[model samples]
Target: MGLFSKDIKTMDDLFVHTLKDIYYAENQILKALPDMIEKATDGGLKQGLQAHLGETKNHVVRLEQVFKMHGAKAEGVACPAIDGIIEETNEIAGEIDDKKGLDAALIAAGQAVEHYEMTRYGTLIAWARQLGRADCANILEQNLKEEKAADAKLTALAERGINAKAA
Candidate 1:
């Protein structure tokens, strides 16, 4: 069912729907990260993307676990927000010819993905708590922490040199 579908008549339904949305998004990121890794010119950026790719795979597994805990099928629904973010990343990356500029754009793109995930996981954790599923909330908190760390890493990388190199 769509986000506005009348079938989601309760908080549980909304929670599950959002869960499916992130599940879909995480899977999509799994598919997209390799290309981003390939496009990255900076060694640090490449290694960082590779590390997050592994974390993202675990994120998918953790999401599946949450689905099982919630008594829902481990499945996904289309997530246009992540799709758009990835598309924008690809478009911007394509436009940049300089290695440093491309690396900078890639870091920005990675941070954008992390920010999106942080928002989703944060909301999911809050909703899980409100739904009285502290178990699920606690599990989701791990993913949220990882997302925040990933963003911070990207910021540090940029501050250290990627941004200046781009200039």
Candidate 2:
């Protein structure tokens, strides 16, 4: 259902819809990360992306758990936002020939993905609490914490030398 679908008439419905949105996004990120890991030129960048791939897998599991806890079907809805971000990342990565530049681009793309995840997780956590699903929120907080750490690692890699190497 669309975000504004008439089917979602209650706040709980909105919460579940967003939960599915992130579920779909995390799965998409899982699909995209291996290619990003392969394309990464820097060893550190490659390693970080690989590690996060593992975490992203856990994220999908956690989201499934949340769905079960909330008594909702464990499934995903189409998330156009994540689709656009992944598409943009692929287009940019394909255009860059320089290894250093590609590494830098990869970091940016990873951050874009992280930022999107952070927002969704944050919203879901809040909504979970509001809906009296503290159990679900606690589990989701784990995913959010890891996403923040991943984002920070990407920034550190960029600032430490990746961007300068590209320059």
RMSD of each: 0.8, 0.5
Candidate 2 residue pairs in backbone clash: none
Residue 165 in candidate 2, Cα distance off native in Å: 0.5
- Over 91-160, each residue of candidate 1 has an lDDT whose tens digit, in order, gives 9989998989999999999999999999999999999999999999998999999999999999999999
Shift in Å, residue 24, candidate 2: 0.4
Tell me the TM-score of each prediction against the true structure.
0.98, 0.99
> What tens-digit string does per-residue lDDT give for candidate 2 at 1-167?
78999999999999999999999999999999999999998999999999999999999999999999899998889999999999999999999999999999999999999999999999999998999999999999999999999999999999999999999
What C-alpha root-mean-square deviation, in Å, does candidate 2 show against the real structure?
A: 0.5
Model 1 off-target regions past 4 Å? none
- Model 2, position 69, has a per-residue lDDT of 89
For model 2, the stretches where C-alpha displacement exceeds 4 angstroms are none
TM-score between candidate 2 and the true structure? 0.99
